[model samples]
Target: MTGIPKTYQRIVLAARPRGPVAPENFRLETLDVPELADGEVLIRNHYLSLDPYMRGRMSSAKSYASSQPLDQTMIGGTAGQVVASRNDYYRVGEFVGGMLGWADMGVSDGVLLRKLDTTRIPLSTYLGVVGMPGMAAWYGFNQILEAGAGDTVVVSAAAGAVGSVVGQLARLRGCRVVGIAGGPEKCEYVVKQLGFHACVDYKAGNLEADLAAATPDGVDAIFENVGGACLDASLARTNAFARVALCGLIAGFNGQEMPIKNSRLLLLNRVTLRGFIITEHMEFWQQGLQELAVLVANHQIKYRETVAEGLAAAPQAFMGLLQGHNFGKQLVKLI
Candidate 1:
């Protein structure tokens, strides 16, 4: 990339969203794909991941992770083939996944962008199953909550990326699984496709009643994704010494504040809650990727993604993810 492009597609934060993100908050424009130096690689993005955590990145406030700069390209996970390389760690034609953001072209030093082994799975799979979400489920189950067979597991946002896999993995472990999603369709998919014993829809109302019916025996483990009312509902059914794997808070992604009733439920139940971003244990990334490959090869796991075509639709698709409008793992296809 001696002489890079004068303009490239990018999604920028025009303004901090007060509530739900609107089209006005994001402004898409063209910018230069910076020239790569020695030991750097230039990648033409073929796919970009849209996760719920991205919503918090738009704000300028201090968070668990650093916030994205205003009027700059939105931060996101992406997968693409390397087009230019100057490092031995990466070579041209190799696919990679990392924080490439929403851009048509990206230049990185391979520090953040890890070289992906495309031989094991599809390039897009790197963004879902074998990527961050996969690592998230592994960490949440194996390390954080430490789930096991005979445990009753409940997962919120169970049709989404990490939650979906967590629910299914619990089922494979012989644990009773209950999923909480948004609507009838997603709830049905969670039970039918992900192999959950039952699925509850928060949008259908009476969260307490639905959650009670779903896990009548009391929930022993919780793979938490959506917070707020859903969190409250889960707390109501938690058994003694319940382990809660705090994954994400997509419930607040819409910028709406959620109220948690009776904070004593955690203290009363002796619940052990562990919050994580999945990157905390980068050491387990390889382990997760390898294990997921075995599962995929053995036909023990299933996955899905909602791909949005074109770079221009990236912002809208991203917003759609925050609203639970996306059916599965959301991705933007560039080429």
Candidate 2:
């Protein structure tokens, strides 16, 4: 609390994007910090998470979550330290995770924020492997796909936060895992470092052929992250009774239309496709968090991150994430 400041800088939604989001869509503002009332806690954010789902929140379209209001602090996940506190539960100098948005500092009433133990793992890990993205891969892989050993599993956007975990979990379950990433570097990292059985570079202009070659036995489980060509290619290679966990549609995030042309493949293959958001299944949170933390702790899972240096770089970093420019998890370091 000794070095805590009285004001902070934050980014707000200045305008909705007409197509792909740009830096002009956001505005930065400096403001006086609010005095903490009884039961309120002040947080000084250390890391801000950049995710693909955020693109949907920018548009005023029907989505599982409500649209982000204009001129408001842009919505985000943050890991930070409690700089000051009047709340009985949270203490000063303790780390916490919350939806504190794109702010250098924030105040909360101890509602959504959760205390974190930064002693064991890197504090930023809470924003990636041990956070929402990890929970997403956990639920999608275990609950939705119910993948079994010896199954041929395929995951798109395989180098990303959720996709990387999905591939690793599937491989750990004794499945032959194949990943689809954007470039040769990511593909190499996916197969060599992450231990996926194979990785296809979708940007190589051989998606259908490469995927077909990779999953020669046909895909038993598909974790669909990028929707357009990747989903289409996976659908074409599905075995009967295949399970498809539809995650993020990063391919069409810039307002491109996503239409399924392989209708016959689904009926012929008897595939099961389920789109899920981790927030909807609160019952699985405890189990998922425990398993994810354990895997991370034991080194059974590997993760990577592309860190943006500061809050001002968040907008551009996020834009890069949408284009598959990030090698792994995209994050903004605010400290």
Candidate 3:
């Protein structure tokens, strides 16, 4: 803590977006690092996670969670090292993960912080693969979908943090996995790199036909990330009693309407669709993180990230993510 800076830069939610998010929605502020009280810890964040779910947080519309208040630090997950501490449980230099918002430094009372062990996995991954995204994938796939051997599992936004893990886990369970992504490059990575049996490029303008071709046996389970046309196409090809883990609806994040044209299939096919918010299910996180950590450490799982440099870049990076420009988990390197 000897060379710690007296002040730090942080990005706050300057304004709420009306439609698609813009750079004007965020504002950077420089503030003095506060003096720690009896049981507080200071963290120097290394990475900031920019996720699709964050878009919902930026709106005033009613949802499962409260909207991010304006003129405050933009809400986000952070991975960092404890630079200073007056807390007995957390010592200086320990790696940690927390909801530290979009800032290079944050202070906590240790209640919301989780000490991390980077020995088996990288610290940055704690914000992606083995963190909230990984837990969401695990809970949704294992608990809801319950996909097993001989099943045909389809993952939309397969190149992203959550969907990527879902596809790989399904593959590990001896299921035939098909990925739906935005481009030929992402599709190739899903099959060639992530080991999915097939990948359908939704941007190819043949979503329905291509998805049908990919899942000739009919989709047994779907980890849906992008809703609209991708979900409609998959729903049209579902087998009877298929399960759908409705995750993010990123296609409609910008106020665009995303209606499922084949919604009638939900009744005809007797599909079981469940939408979940991972934060509501905290009890399963430890169990899920342990499994994900081992898989990541042993190279049994693969992940990719598109990182923007510094706090000021988070807004642009996040906007790009919503527009489907990012290839994988979008993040900001704060340090």
Could you give candidate 2's per-residue lDDT for residues 80-199 as a string of tens digits?
Answer: 999899999999989999999999999999999988887677888888999999999999999999998999999999999999999999999999999999889999999999999999
Off by over 4 Å in 1: 1-7
The root-mean-square deviation over C-alpha atoms between each candidate and the true structure, in angstroms, is: 1.9, 0.9, 0.8
lDDT preference between candidates 1 and 3, better one: 3
Ten-residue segment with the worst summed lDDT in candidate 2? 1-10
lDDT of 3 at 116: 96
Decide which is better by TM-score, 1 or 2. Answer: 2
lDDT at position 293, candidate 1: 73
The whole-model lDDT of each prediction reads 0.85, 0.92, 0.93
- Per-residue lDDT, model 2, residue 57, is 97
Q: Which ten residues in a row have the lowest lDDT in candidate 1?
A: 1-10
Cα error of candidate 1 at position 152, Å: 0.6
Please give, for residues 86-204, the per-residue lDDT of candidate 3 as tens digits: 99999999999999999989999999999999887888899999999999999999999999999999999999989899999999999999999988999999999999999999888
Full-model lDDT, candidate 3 = 0.93
Model 1, 1-335: lDDT tens per residue? 54445667888888988888888988888776666688989888999988888788888778988888888888889999888888889988888887878888888888898777777567897888777887898789888777788889999888888888888789888899998999999998998888999999998887889899988889899898988888888989999999988888877775677877947989999999889888778888888888987886677888889999988898788878887887768999998
